[model samples]
Target chain A: MIRQTLRMARWEVIKLRRRWMPWVFLAFIVLSSQLRLLTEYQMYSNADPGRIAVQAGPANEEGEHSTISISCLDIRDGLVESRLSGIPTEFRQAALQEVESLRDRCPALLGMYDFARTNFLNNATLPGSLSYGINMFGTLGYLFVMILAAMAIGVEYTWGTARQVLAKGCGRGRFLAAKVLGLLAVVGIGHLAVILFMGISSLIITYTMAGTGISTDVMQWLRPGADVVKSMYMMLPYIILGTFFAVLTSSASSGIVISVVFYISESILRWIIGSYLGPDAARILISVNTPLWMASLEFPALNNLSEIYNYLRDFLSTFLPILAYIVVFWGGSFWLFKRRDLKPSTGV
Target chain B: MMASNDLVIKTESLTKRYGDILAVNDLSLEVPRGHVFGLLGPNGSGKTTTMGMLLGLVRPSAGRFSLFGGRKPHREALTRTGAIVEFPSFYPHLTGRDNLAFFQEISGNGDSVELDTLLEKVGLDGRGKDRFQTYSLGMKQRLGLAYVLLGDPDLLILDEPTNGMDPDGMAEVRELIRSLGDGERTVLLSSHLLHEVEQVCDSVAILSHGRLVVQGRVDELVRSLAGETILLRTTDNAKAIEILSKLNWVTDLNSKGESILVSAPTLRSSELSEVLSRSAVYVAEMTLGHVSLEEYYFKITDDANGDTA
Candidate 1:
């Protein structure tokens, strides 16, 4: 059975490679990663840092709002009058210290762009791109992986090849298991491509744009690597769900429709369940927990103890349910494939 | 009785039900080793259903079957068996050779040389590189044959394998099936084409309304089901019946509208006529006639239909 399954898996990858959809999906991911890197770098590079405007974000519950519209040069030159005038009274003192620090870094106008470039490099580079692409991979991988899983499983029944396979003594359970594993391999390779592509391209872009002062500790990647691992596992539930629907309905279209519908409807369902019920109810959703679990790692390690605590809470809550969904969907699919009589393909 | 070891397939009251419909009912059957066996049935007669059950595509609702004498184990038995239960289904995107290669590899015969040989055996050489979706129906059927021939399986089960093929393609497939079943291997063929079965099968089981109507060697069943008949117009019809009835080969002797119908081998028409003339019941007209498998099929199925009605 194991040998047969491996053969099936090897053939599955071969079949998928001969097709065009997976490559197109991977291309979209790789190109999108580069596009984002270029877009961010372009936004920062084109800015006139000498006269660039700065603004604070919206206020907290304590009404601590502050908006700074003064030019960077005004702050860089220690022109305290122009900078302090527009700032609100609640944030006036803290804003002064921040401007003073920037003034010290680029007290000369010639260094303002250099100073601003250094700040933007980290946001557009390897360590940042990992987190950035993790979110992107999860979102896009769910869609692509779900779509691929549907195609991989659905086409067997639609083409009546499942009959051919089972007739050849391939156990129905083994066939499905091999198929799911094959799909995971395809998606795994796709994710790896995105990670490598984004990492390489982001590094190249940062090294080209920053010129110098781009020192990143190797440890900075450890968190993003963990998130990457998390994002990869996150696509499993969708794969199983797609496989389940494909086998249950015995059509690729139903598999695709239902899986996509589920993928799309999940957020709405989570929102509805959460709104009328509560957030705890929403966190029960796999996709909902995924982003929260991913976002957990983004919480700073500084004096953000409570934020870290919430991150831990979401992480702990996220793991088991995602695993449970995977087990349920995969088990349901295997049972269906094993027990149900395999009819020839009815139609498209 | 054929030894149990000689039976490649044995079913004991095997049955399958889809809701209220009995797709296959108490199907007790055997296909002896190294014989081309025909499973003949009309549409919905459970021929394909029975094959499906044997090949593990459909689970039987009742009863049990053992493949290859149940000695080598189920999966191993299947590995030595090749089947095309319904139509030839394949990935439309794959080239014919690629599709063969895929199933070939999965069946554990990853030999490229064997795949090419099977493709050539099915007369699908050179055209094997074309995508399945682009191939004509005949080409697709040929590809299916190639796939089934992989692993050099000992037993081959084909259900309407020649469907969607031209007459020439049908003949080619028929010849291929006959060659595959030549002394060394067993072929369980299910086809609605009685003539194809007649030409290729060594033994057959005719199914009617999900029940076995009759089973025997093609020659025996065709001979016995509606025994060979001689239509005779004579000066003395009563005398002709009397004379022919006395012959040991004559199973039934009766008078029809204007002639005597003697149920005996049409091959012995000369002896029959000579017997009549010798008996002084001189024949004005005599013509040899016999029921073919087609005629026997309809006759038995109509009788089966009548029985249930």
Candidate 2:
């Protein structure tokens, strides 16, 4: 079984290499990340660092000061000017409580504010592109990995290759196992390639646009590395879940539709559950604790300010549920393939 | 009874059902070692479904089958049995060589020389490098045959192996199937073409609506249907016709041209000759017509369907 599965895995890799899916998805990520970095640089270039554009605020007699003004040069400086003490009494209490919560959660950023005062803001910073790319990685990576993984497995049934494989004496469970392993390999290799490409490209862009010296900040380094690993961990469940749907449904279109619907609807579902119910109740959803929850790593404030992560880390750091979801999806797929007859599938 | 090891496939009351539809029902059969066997049935007669069950692509709803003398189907047993059920399906993006190489690897026999030779045998040697999708249907079917021939399995099950082929292609495949029947290898060929099966197979099983209608040696099944008609060209045709018509065993007699066509229910040509010679009407030529597989197939299927005609 192991040998047969390895052979099937090799075949799947060869087939995947022959297709445009992985390379195209990887290229899209690299190109889009670089382009978005360029766009950020263009928008922030030659700005008056001291001028604070307050998009909204309460109307007051002393309008400019009543509306908070923070320098664009540093987020720390801007956040200080955003202190709740200056707010009107009506909104002051609520704002202070939120700020107090954020201050406690993001101790690293707040602690390093004094040291980061000399650094330039936005795209002028050396690690700006890398940070921005890592920020966008989770959501975009989720969509790409889910779509391609579903299509890869689902095409076997659509194209009738699954029947051929089983007819050749490879067991159905082994065949599905090979697909799961093959998907993991593709996901691992594709993600590694995307990270390396984006990292190197961001380095070049930062060196050319800003100066040569890069930030040595621990959080800056730790955040991207953590995000990269977390994004991979976050992607495995989606990949497995996508494949599960593809095998169950036996149609790429159905798999794509099901996965995309789940993805798009998860955030809405999380909101509805969290709003009416509570955050604890909402976290019961695997989707709530997975892509979106993991994607919150992209925004420092979102991860730090939300109490969901706090509650999550209490139970083996919230990995138990995600791991269980992966096992269920993968095991369900294996069972389905093993027991179900290999009918000539036309639609799904 | 033959030893169990000498039988390549044995199914005991094997059955398969899809929802309420019984695709294959209580099909018990034995394909002995070293003969080309034909599994003949019309469309939806469960030919492909039974093959699918044997190949482990479809699960039986009840009963069981053994491959290579084993009591249950397994990967190792199946590795020795190659098959192409229904249409030949392949990865269109890969080259034909790559497709065969993939199956060969999965089969784990890892005989590259055999793979090359099988490709050559299927007349796809030079064309193996072309993408499968680019190949025509005939080329694809040839490649499919090459795929089954890989690893040089002892048993081969082919379902409609000549589907979508021209006459020349069908003849080529028939020859190919016939050639696979060495004294040590068995071939179970499922087809709707009676003539092809008759030309190639030594033994055959006819299936109708998921049940085994009849199974035996090809010649035996044909012989069991009816005796052959004996045609004789005599110098004195009236005398020969009169003598043959008067015989008690001669069921029907017709005179045409300078010959007498005698439907001998059980008598041979020599017996007819004795009567003709005794009647002083010497036969210049005598030919005994063999019952064709086509005729026997229609007769049995019609009988199975309870058709009076």
Best by lDDT: 1
CA deviation > 4 Å runs, candidate 1: A42-120, A211-216, A296-314, B226-228, B233-283, B287-289
Taking all chains together, each candidate's TM-score versus the true structure is 0.82, 0.78
Model 2: runs farther than 4 Å from truth? A43-47, A51-135, A209-212, A215-226, A291-317, A345-348, B71-73, B111-113, B228-264, B268-289, B307-309
Q: How far does residue B66 in candidate 1 sit from its true spot (Å)? A: 0.9
Model 1 lDDT per residue over B100-171, tens place = 888887788659899789888888888888889998888888888888888989999998888999988899
Best by TM-score: 1
Report the poorest 10 consecutive residues by lDDT, candidate 2 chain B.
B258-267
Tell me the deviation in Å of residue B121 in model 1. Answer: 1.1
Native contact recovery (fnat) for each candidate is: 0.76, 0.80
